[model samples]
Each structure stands twice: as C-alpha cells, then as structure tokens.
Target: MRTTHAHPIAAALAGLALLATLSGCAGSTAARSDAAAGGPAAPVPAAAGAAAADEKAASTSEGTAYAAPGASERQLARTAKLTLVIPDPAKAAKELRGVAEGLGGYLLNENVVTEQKDGYYVEPSTVTVAVPGTKLDDALDALSKIGEVRNRNVGSVDVTTDMVDLEARIASLRASIARVQGLMDKAGTITEIAQVEKELTSRQSELESMLSKQKALAGRVAMAPVTVTLRPPSVVIQDPNPLWQGLTAGWAGLLQSLRMLLTIAGALLPFVVLGVLIWLPIRVWRRRRRPNAPGLLASVLAPATVDAEDVPAAKPLDAPRDRPTTVDG
Candidate 1:
C-alpha cells in the first residue's frame, strides 16, 4: 500500500513539470515571431505603449501647427499710385478705364477737373481702380504705355498674421457657439434658457462682425487698388529773348506791386474815412465855440511871416552913435 501511494504522487509531479515546460516554450515562440516581424522582442506594458503613442501624436500635431508657411500661403495687400503726363488727360483716362476692365478690374472712382491754365482749358483726370492682385503688374505695364510716367509708387502690406489670427478667432467663436447651442438644447429651466439665448445672440452678433471683417480683409488681399493721376503735358513758354523775358517779369512785378498797393489802400480807406468824419465834426465845433479867435489857417501861417508896419527901422551904426553922444553933451 505504501509503494502504490508513492508511485501515484511521483506521476502527478511529473505531469505538472511537463505542463510548465510547454507554457514556457509557447511564450518563447511568441517572442521569436514578434522579433522576426520587426516588433518588440519583449512584451511591452499596455500603459507604456499608450503613453508613447500619445507623445508621438502630440508631437505631430504641434509640428503641423507651427510649420512655416510657404510663399504662396502669404497674404499681401498691394496698392499703387501713378502720376502720368499725357497729351490729353481726358482721352488717357478713358483708355485707362478700358484697360482696367480688360484686366478683370473695375473703376472705383473717376474725377475730371477742367481749369483755365495759361489762357487754355486744361482737363486733369484722377482715376482709381481695383484690379486682381495677380494682374497688378500687367495693369501697371498697360498704364505705362498710355503716357509718360512722371511718378510711380508701389506698396505692399503683409497680412498673413492677421489672416491667421482671424481664422483662429472665427474657429474659436464657432466652437463656442456650438457648445452654447448644445447647452441650450439641454437647458431645463426658463432662466437657463434665457441666459443661454442671450449668450447665443451675443456670440452670433460677434461672429457676424468677425465675418464682415474677414470679408473686407480678404477683398483687400485679393484686389490691388491703383490710383492714376492723368495730367496734360506742361506748357512751355518758349520766348528766346532774354530782354523780353526780363521785361515780362518786370511788368508782372509791377502789376503785383500795384495790386498789393491797391489792397493796402483799400484796407486803410475805411479807417481813414472814419477818422476824417470824426475830426471834421470836432474841428467845426471848436471853431463855432470861438468865432473871435484867429482862424486856424491864419494862426498856423502867422509864425511864417511878419507885417511891414511892425518892423523897426535900423540906423547907420557910425552916424547914430555920434548924434547920441552930442545930444548927451
């Protein structure tokens, strides 16, 4: 009986050892297969694997967000001002309008001013046009062909940052509005609904304003404004004689002096007339108060002359002295 019991216990121990060996072999085979397939040689922990995946995803997103924009992605608003000297400004202005229309542009404004210059009517035109940004150069070239370019100025403003900021704000506002809408749907009380509605209205209004700004900015970026000033060729006075020029200049100076003198005289005439009116009345009153007094004209002339009867006779110096000495004796 003791031998049978010992034999059964030994068989049970051998079976347990064989099962352990099989499980170890299975694990080793799995590891080898994973390695052969370019996977981890050892089993990774689930938490560690998940953390690494999250880190990689975050890095990718960050890189994407901060990547530098290419040249085509840049937003620029361009404007140009040109002053052209042409033979006929009115004709040039009309031609410029056609050119603008041909190049996918429209005339924004046009003003024609007719003025008399040097005894001739001169028509100067100012035209403002909006053209596609891509065609700005072409439009300028066309303008150059129309007349002599006296002045040309081209300017650009980079608006990429502004555009990006607008887009981000719009996205944020939309998300916020969506969240508010979800809250509205779930709101249970009247007060909650009212508050949610108010917030929604405010956000919607803000969104509309933002959208309007975006539209304006985008329009500026897409279209380039060009201002063209068309002026007739300057009139050249071609008098070859220096003497004539001097005489003309002297005559002009004389006329200008006369005009200045007239202006000054005109300005002083009123005050002079007022002073005369006041002084005449005062002088008349003083004369009327003292009628016996010498006339003012006579009083003023009295000091300048002497009457013949009032003058004393002069005696000869030698004769007069001898007579006085005899009489005293």
Candidate 2:
C-alpha cells in the first residue's frame, strides 16, 4: 500500500513540473514575439527610445533648417525687371535672346510693338526670359552692355521652409503607404483589404501632389526670371541760343494754332455741307412762289372803282328855302 501511495505522489509531482515548464516556454515565446512586433512587452524602454529618436530628429532638422549666411544651399527665387533704351530695340531683343541661350536659359515671352514716331516706324520689344540662378548677375551684366538701363529692379523670395515641409510630408506619406500595403496583405476580409487599399490610394495621391509642388518649387529656385523692356533712344535737339529757342517756340506755337484751326474746320465741314444742301432746295422753292406773290400783293393794294349811276345826287338849296318860309311866318 505504501508503494502504491508513493507512485501516485511521484506521478502528480512530475505532471505539475511538466505543466510549469510548458507555461514558462509559452511565456518566453510570447515575450519574444511582442518585442519583435514592438508591442507592449517593453513599453517603458520603447517609449524612452522613441522620445530620444524624436529629439534627435528634431535637433538635426533644426540644425539644417537654413543655409549659412552666404551659402548657396538656400532656396531662392530671383526676378529682375530692366528698362533699357537702345538704338535698335528689335536687334537688342534678338541679342538678348542669344544671350539667354548662351547662358543655358530660354525665352518665356516676347512682345514687339511697332509705333510711328516722327514719320518713322519704331519697334520696341518687351522680353521675359529665365536663366540659371547662379548666373543671374552675369546675365544682368551682359544685358547692361546691350543698352542704357533706365530702370532696374531685383527681387528674391526664400522657399527653403516650404521645400523642407514638402519633403517631410512626402516621406511620411511614403511610409504610411508602405504600412497600409502591408496591412492590406495581412487583411483577412474583403472589407479590411478595401479599406487599406483606399487609404493607400489616398496617401499616394497626396504624395504625388506634394512631389509636384516640390518639383515646381525646385524649378523656381533653380532658375531666375528676367524681364527686359527695350525701347528706341529718344531724339533730343539742343539749341543753346536763347533767340533760336524763342524763335523755335514761336514757330511751334503758330503751327499748333494752325493745326487747331484746321481740325475745327474739318469737324464743321460735314455739318456745313448738310446745311447748304437743305437750304438750296428751300431757296429754290421760295423763288418759284415769289412770282405769284407779287400779283396777290397788287390785287390787295389797288383802289376800288365805283359805278357812274351808283352815286346819289347831292341836294342843292332845299335847306335855304325852308329857313326863309319859317322866318316870314
């Protein structure tokens, strides 16, 4: 009976040990998997490491945020406007185009205007071109040799911050897209797969937009825009003598007065012709009626003649005979 009791106790003890061993192995395996998946197995260390990484990234980004004072790494978009008075605007414009091409640039736009000046056709040109940002000063210098610069303006804009922001966002979107793709691969249901795919598509679209903006911004920083306005040299007449100046002024005034009078006459010519055309017909009509008018006037003004027996004979002495009979009575 003691042997039987010992056997049962030993079996129970062995089973318990085996169960404990199994539990330990499972716990270790789970802990390793959680660590590999960056799960909550070691939350405190992971959090600390993440914080350190974030601080490091922030410090590095801040350090490289801007270029040094004179460094060329700074992204700048440069533009210049120049007004030049040259002898021949057309020729100058052609030369300017060649200059831009020589400097590895291209013309963006050109407008040539032909105007009449002093009985001569003058062609003035306005040209816009782009050149390498580094060669902007050189281009300006070369252009200055083409003509006398009457006006000049140079401007610059910094886009480093925008470029940096775009780059960061693009990187983030790429990582997010990759993570979503992984999730899609692991998805068990159609709904989860569709949702992951939709998220991926959205992120990809955002990434593409950011890339486009970045490319445009980079192009602007790489090239500088220049606008050149070329005009013909003005003619200046110099007369030092006061008498000659006075005579010239008087002649100019007389010519201006004559021009004004001619302009007034030209404006009135049509109205005057219209008035004469209307008056001539009326005058002709009145002349035709005047021949009949005289007869009507004669009929109205002539004295009327009375018939011979129409007048009664005047009484001669009847009044005197009546007065004498009254006196005798």
Full-model lDDT for every candidate: 0.68, 0.67
- List ranges where model 1 is wrong by over 4 Å: 1-72, 119-124, 234-329
Winner by lDDT = 1
Question: Pick by TM-score: which candidate is best?
Answer: 2
Candidate 1 lDDT: 0.68
Error of 2 at 73 (Å): 3.2
Q: Which residue pairs in model 1 clash with each other?
A: none
Q: How well is each residue in 1-329 modelled by candidate 2, as lDDT tens digits?
A: 44433433333223322322332233344233323433322122444335434643553464343321123357888999999987666788899999999999999999877676784446667999999999999999998889998998999999877776665554444433443444444455555555556666766677678667777887887789999998887767775899988999999999999999999999999999999999999999998978788888999999998987998887776554454435555
What TM-score goes with each of the models? 0.53, 0.54
Which runs of model 2 end up more than 4 angstroms from their true locations?
1-72, 119-124, 235-302, 307-329
User: What is residue 271's positional error in candidate 1, in angstroms?
Assistant: 9.7
lDDT for 329 (candidate 2): 50
